[model samples]
Target: MAEITDTALQGTSKSPNTITLQEFNNRIKRLLADPSVMNCWVVAETTDVRINQHCYLQLLEKNPKTGATVAKIKAIIWGNQFRFLNARFKQVTGRDIGNDMKIMVCLSVNYSPQYGLTVVINDINPEFTLGDMERQRQEILNRLTQEGIIGQNKTVPVPPVLQRIAIVSAAGAAGYGDFMKQLTDNKYGVCFYPCLFQATMQGVKTVPTVLAALDKVEQNQHLFDCVVIIRGGGGTEELNSFDNYDLARRVATFPLPVIVGIGHERDITVLDYVAGIRVKTPTAAAEHIILQAANALAHIGDLSNQVVSIARDYIARAKEQLSYYAGNLPIMAQRIIDTNTLRLQNFIQNIPLHVQRRIEGENAQLARQKDAIKNAVAQVKMKETMRLEALGDKIELLSPRKVMARGYTLTTCEGKIMTDAAQLEAGKLVTIHFRDGKVVAGTQSVIKDK
Candidate 1:
């Protein structure tokens, strides 16, 4: 490097009218201020900015892919133009004037005698940054698609009613406030229970902070029906965190369905594509919930109306059927009464003749029954008397008196009747009984009969 500097100095030494470096620099200033140089726009990345009376920046143009520096120059926004260009940049991008941002600046080329060659940034074009942002978003989306997670949250079924919701947002954000108010005062009178997991929703820390909030929700996923990410209105550039790949992936693959209402109108973030639903604003998200409940309730009401209509039709048909039955009631009743009266009159006219015939038959039957009963009684009594007479004869034959009269006499020694001669002693008094009388005797002699 020193050899190069010395060689360049050697060439300057060759000029006999060697001008001061300041004089040379002053000449270059005259050349750069020409219309052609001053009118050009240059694209570069800001670096090493120093902000004071002027905002001095080192602007670098680098290899887009390799990132090798191709050009570097000193640049400045003078205190006068600083206010205008910074405001314009911020107005378009929702970002502060800062280092590392790709910027397109229209330059007023300058060569300062003391400060050397530099450019004054006269104006900024925010469109270039916006275009780059769109490109980055497309690239992130493509990567997510390739990974097959782009539709992860989209595949998650949105509940018919999301009564419990977990929210990720800054605690004091206007978006959060609007969401709560809209849900609380919904025309449908639907109720929603919301839990806030507060996180920074803008700036570089936004992604990680919101991711942490998501993790908290995941730990208690059963408590929530869905997750909602909300941010207050801001410039399109403020949506960088929502477009961040990690945050987008987290949202895309979250277990619960995610509803995103972060960016302003028409601004699509990568998170929006992967989330279950995307709405224009936080209030819209709340309204969507209300609408869901209202629609379901309306369906119930419609069914009730259908049931009532069917019931009314059935009742009308029944009424018609009853009217037809009523119209025929008198005729049917009279026909039935006429048939019954004819039957009753026929029965009444036959009554006397039926009674006379019945009585004659009954009298004949009674006489026959009386004769049969008398014969049965006479036969039963005759048989019973004959049996009694036979029984009496048999009894007379078995009588003891009749046996005595047949010449069998009873003898007694003293009082008891004796059947054996051993009952008397040789001199004992004895009595004998014949059929007619009793005889007194003495057992004076003993005799043994062979």
Candidate 2:
């Protein structure tokens, strides 16, 4: 294309100050191609972005105060330049350029009669977009803090074991799949019941869809122990939706504790600040739940072991007490019998002396009186001996061992002697003791007399 000068337009025109459309376009191109204008830096908001072999965009400027579109221009990045710029942009900002994103680009001015003026973008400054995004993020955070709702979800109590979960993520998303896999395939063999609420996790629909999903989760909140929001890895552009104030507010004030794992390690969104817990990745979220359940299981196991230990110790002590009582009962009974027998023998010996003295004194009275006295003494001795024999027999029959031997048995329930049928329940376990051994039995039914 040839550059047309104002002097040349003057020379070629049969009509003064008039040029063909092609000539006019050429002039505009020539003027824009000035060395000073080449590779000039421009800042604009991107709209209607399209990527093919070459990336095309509509760069627009909006009034800062009124937010009304003021100036608009077409732009392009050649395939080679686009590849490098896009990669570098994503690297620096953790996001790819997309619609409605503010961006700065170095570009060269170009013009064509057919396609009109378009800027050829040579390079992009990712920091510009990053600064814009950070500014918006900070605004939302400040608003939440002012409302005092930033810590609302954090105050929600999480259960000791998170067995039931409400998951918010795009269905079949890599992050969702990873979370489920990590949660269900845990080494602890813990069980989890997760109900997924599908939503678009990126782009313009991200905020509304996520809010709807959270609403659904709230509807069935009782069914879930906590709510988990997760997304797979994506460019920072995709994460911008999570920085939305509406989504953040909803998550912040949610009734159930909210756990967010929506970004990479360094990718923190507004949701991260308001959520009850935040983790780096979806897998990390799953690991957290699994860890809680595993810990609870471990605690239960410890408690069970302690209970068993206590019960065993109690049984050991009971057995020792029973053994001591069983061994001493016979000895105690025999000692009582021996003491009584000695008293009877002493009485019998004194009776003989008293009888001899009575007989000597009565000898002068009469032989008949003496005979009667001797017979009475003999009868008294025989009677006393018979009474001692009877007393010993009564003692032997009243002994526990003797009673058990004579068709009697002892029964206990829950380690206590069961003296009444009222204490027995239908399915109660009881121990029945005989003189020789013990039997354990369960009650089929209990009958108590009125």
Candidate 3:
């Protein structure tokens, strides 16, 4: 050892050791803070991510071939940058990057011996994130299908009429407003009792926040008839949150019917597939409800009209029957009267004819007997003429008509003949019967034997 100078004592340093590890790190930090050596470059794949409460993110990248982490660094996104990054990422990927997603980042390299790490993030490439989103969507879809929960939500019964609805959406979102207005202004007078289960509609925390809202609705199943998940218009990337398999499973197994109104006609999510009903927009969902209500009302109206018509027909038939009976009543009564009058006339005519015939026959028989008696009396008078000459003379004396013929007129009162002088009275009107005629006479005198 030659007598080394004080400089040689530090192993013959070519330059003086003027900087410490802390000093070098501070200098490098200052240089990186400048907008020159710290440039931006896009890299693939995100790894080893940490989030701080200050809204700064620390991330790293690794090499897939070697299974080794070559790019180990500490990258920071400030609170403001973090917000922008989160929003942009969600806009591009429809999801926020945490530990789960892979992202393409624009970053700067930083090297320092004391800090012993490098930083490499400044921005993100949206196109690359979108591509990643498609792959993730397919993966989740496959998982749900394999897990047999793809058709789970479809099994829940949708109410025949969608009256009470539970909505999970960002409050004040244009989508929510549209849905409410459409339902309220429906022409069918459809009523909706909307119970809002508010949640984040987009971002890294969107899935969990939405799931929590769904959980509340599920726990209180009686409060709602159906669950509706709706969102405002957005890019395809922003819709990726709905493709999650876990969220799909939850929706599939929900007790009540689920409806999704998430995107336009071109966009279809896993949630849409799992939901019992999927509509292109929130307004369309409202229209579906109105249509169901209209159909029900129309059916009821038809039934009511049918019932009324049937009642009217029955009344008309009854009136016709009553009129028929009333019209026939007079004719039936007249027929009865005519029949009874004909029978009484026939009976009276027959009775009179029969009585007249019977009286005429009896009179004829009496006449014949009288004639025979008269003939017998004449023969007897001829045979006894000689012997009865004296009797004949006596009979002639007793005969009143013979006495009247002999100029002795017979006087009778009330059909009795007056044959004695005692029957005469003074001032009495009497009938005198001769053999040929009767005379009215007044008695002049009367005498009575003592």
Over the stretch 1-450, how does candidate 3's per-residue lDDT look in tens digits? 578687667776477668776887887677767666466564545545566742434454667687666654456665667778788876665556655456667676676755555664567776786776778778877887888877877887776777888999988899999999998998766677888899988766779989999999988999788999999787665776788877888888888888899977767888887888899998888887788878888988999999999999999999999999899989989998999999999989899798999899999999999999999999988888866887888898898777667787767876777767676679888997778987897877787777
Q: Give each model's whole-structure lDDT.
A: 0.86, 0.91, 0.78
**Candidate 1 — worst ten consecutive residues by lDDT sum?**
1-10
Order of models, best lDDT first: 2, 1, 3
Put down candidate 2 lDDT per residue, 1-450, tens digits, no spaces.
999999888888475677798888888878877888688898999999999999999999999999999999888999998999999998888877778889999978877778887779988999989898899999999999999998999999889999899999988799999999999899999878999999999888998888999999888888999999999887777888898899899999999989999878988999999999999999999999999999999999999999999999999999999999899989989999999999999989899899998998788678877888999999999999999999999999888789899879999998999898988899989999999999999999988788
The list of candidate 2 runs beyond 4 A from truth reads 1-26, 33-38, 112-116, 327-450
2 or 3, which is superior by lDDT? 2
RMSD of each: 18.3, 29.0, 31.6
Better of 1 and 2 by lDDT: 2
Deviation in Å, model 3, residue 107 alpha carbon = 12
Query: How does model 1 score by TM-score?
Result: 0.60
State, as a TM-score between 0 and 1, how close model 2 is to the true structure.
0.66
- How far residue 188's Cα lies from its native spot in candidate 3, in Å, is 2.8
- The top-ranked prediction according to lDDT is 2
Give me the runs in candidate 3 sitting further than 4 Å from their true place.
1-43, 46-131, 328-450
Top candidate on TM-score is 2
2 versus 3: better TM-score goes to: 2
